[model samples]
Target: MQYDIEADWHLLNTCNYRCGYCFFTADTLGDKLQMHASPQQWQSAFDATDFTWLLHMTGGEPSIYPLFAELCEALTKRHFISMNSNLSRPLQSFVERVDPSRVSFINAGFHFEERERRSGNAVFLENARLLQSKGFPLLVSIVATPSALARFEEAADILAQAGIVPIPKILRGSYNGQRFPEAYTEPDRDRFRKFAALAQESYREMLNTSGHPSIDMFGDIHLLYGEPSFTGQLCEAGRRFVNIGPKGDVIRCGGPTVYGNVLAGTFKRAKRAKPCNTGGCIYFCQKYTSGPSGPQETRSGFFDWVADVIGTAKHPV
Candidate 1:
């Protein structure tokens, strides 16, 4: 049998912005002020992994971590790294140290709510442009909230002017009794389609045939409006992808159960994919881990694996 391993590490939960729709709010992340892992802790835990790992580092804004540059430099030496950030922090040090070739990609979230403060939209675009100019692959994404949807075209134009394609992401929370991606009013659906068209012509085509209740290489899909569910499917989560919390507790594909500590290196791998007992998992971890994989018939399967990563890099959520 052949397989691949990917891990999403929540390195910190301290963000500079308080976007109203953020899912990882203070209530969600208990003791949020105290939730951070030192660079040494992360380096040690990462170095313990024996596999050629595809590491996705996320946080309440990973760019704000004190040792962000040092951590990135160390991790890139051993594993492929991808980061999710709000792009509010400095980048020159990162550009100078970490090799762009070792980074799979960076997904920068454009928070419309915070545009008036700090360096604002201009700075965000400049930072993204700088990274791209340095040969780093980056994707700019924005939450499609009602207010943001109102200004989606403007944001897309700015990114386009800077040679960046803006990916309009479905807001994960609910609005006026409607859950997003799973449920949206026809007007809202039409708006999202328009937003996609503004970004790229191909995105319009993707929005059409991509079926209801489908999980593509991009993300979860329901019809223009429908319920999302994953209660009974067999998921290759713990076996293929896992979530490592800041303290190193490992959760299987964002499932509720904690298997063990990856920092201590005590979790065991299954020989085959396992059925997911967790009901209704629609998070990114579940979507990617349980999606599709080509035949892994060759030694290492490096080419196929890299292709998969590249495919995902194009559709950063």
Candidate 2:
């Protein structure tokens, strides 16, 4: 199901877990949940655009959003959906209600150390396996912080019980007062490379056919070596990709250019790709823009399969 545009929709701030590495801390993701509109309203708003959208449902945790299953059901009726979730919500409703074909993929974050502290891995495992059984394109990953990498093997063994391995998601930004991918030690890097290779092999069939996971494991693996700069380049962000805030405020990529509110049915889209000056989500930069060097993603066979599956960073994004 190829789409005209892909939106990184920030659904809500409500979350169930408090992982130390999360950009949103416990205080930021507090207990209060907000639902801006009903499923039908959201569906109508997108319909008003007269565009077939591929919405990347994101949040502090999207599954925790009120009537999440209904939202997925309604949105996928005309548009497509991919999700980023913690696998903490009960998916019985989602699995039964939403169509697997309409779903591009699901990137389930397996927060190991946090789950261990709160004893949530069992539920995580159950949910992860359940989705796989339903034929949803799924990728389970662990953010490769020092503690998670140390505990990777044990976590991998646990996931192996369900016939899947958690990929090493490179830790970015700041953690424990240290900026990462760079903060990693030689031993840490070796371990990350090893697991990444194993995970790539484990998910070979999926990657080869469906697409790269919502979190690009290969791009992340490369980031462990060096950070690529794509500050100014010709990008398709505004035209083919956009960032949507929780209220449906549409911003081109992560830039300040307002495309109007999607929920308000006032979006004005770009007709063609343009040069981007902003910086955020390099996956989009690496994908939507063309450049000479740095983060050269070989879009052969499997990666070409990615274009068919999720398209470009129109947010693995």
Candidate 3:
């Protein structure tokens, strides 16, 4: 009952906000047609999996999907359900319909620029409180842009007062002629260090003092403070982890090409971990399939066991 398979489905490319640093730009969104799998399609895909899977739904914003609540209701019955959302939309309806126990967690992104726009901070906080009150494991995260970092203390204070700890994520792209995961300026590096320190402290005080056992904090520290070389390591893509596009095509980890389609019930051979041949490897992509032993031997082992009990393969990648 070692449920080792993990899938991250890019449900759609339609987001309500335009965060300046987002890789998914208006032009990028324009190039791709917005689409979602029907509930039946979701069921078929779940049914077709030879191993149990922890299914993650992500997009421009998953809450905006037309049948979001219905889809959640269906998926929760068969597999663990987790979502990456902006939390700009109301969640009472979703909370009422989907069982909280089946939800692995919700990663809510708080865009500082979007605070003044639709579903402002007040509404976002209210929704978050509602979800937490109902016993949902909610991880509130914010991008650590310089501007966002300037106001982070205030935001952190507010969330801390309400029994919620905010996790600060390193901003992914570049700014002011500097690229990320490669060419961060001294000031940029300092800002991220300060943010991570604050987040670690807050996590200890407000959440669990022991921290997440499976997460390697040292690895995170190295990612920010030092250059990690994955240049020629065997990356376990297509075997234990994969990225499924909106149309159900599977990509090896975050690779550029589609290997197969899950809905077609055709799975390509699980490729052996190979030496990374790309120019640069981003942390997210590297973390997903980096080690030769695969996710089962690392951070996702707990979910693997949980999936065995629930009769599905579960892991988050």
Candidate lDDT (C-alpha), each? 0.63, 0.80, 0.64
Per-residue C-alpha lDDT of model 3 across residues 199-230, encoded as one tens digit per residue: 56655532363234212231233344334444
- Checking candidate 3 for backbone clashes, the offending pairs are 52-312, 52-313, 53-313, 54-314
lDDT score for candidate 2 against the true structure: 0.80
Q: Tell me, by TM-score, which candidate is best.
A: 2
Model 1 local distance difference test score? 0.63
Model 3, runs deviating above 4 Å: 30-33, 181-191, 204-220, 225-229, 269-272, 277-317
If scored against the real structure, what TM-score would every candidate get? 0.78, 0.90, 0.79
Clashing pairs in 2: none
Backbone clashes, candidate 1: 0
Q: What is the C-alpha lDDT profile of model 2 across 1-317, one tens digit per residue?
A: 77888888888877888888888878878848988899999999998999999999887999989899999999999999998999987899999999999998898998888888888878888998899899988888899998889989999999998888888989988899999867889789878888988888888888788766444766565566445555556677888788898898999877778899988888998887677767667565555664433223433333433444443331122
Deviation in Å, model 3, residue 43 alpha carbon: 1.4
lDDT accuracy of residue 272 in candidate 2? 76
What local lDDT score does residue 215 receive in model 2, on the 0 to 100 scale? 47
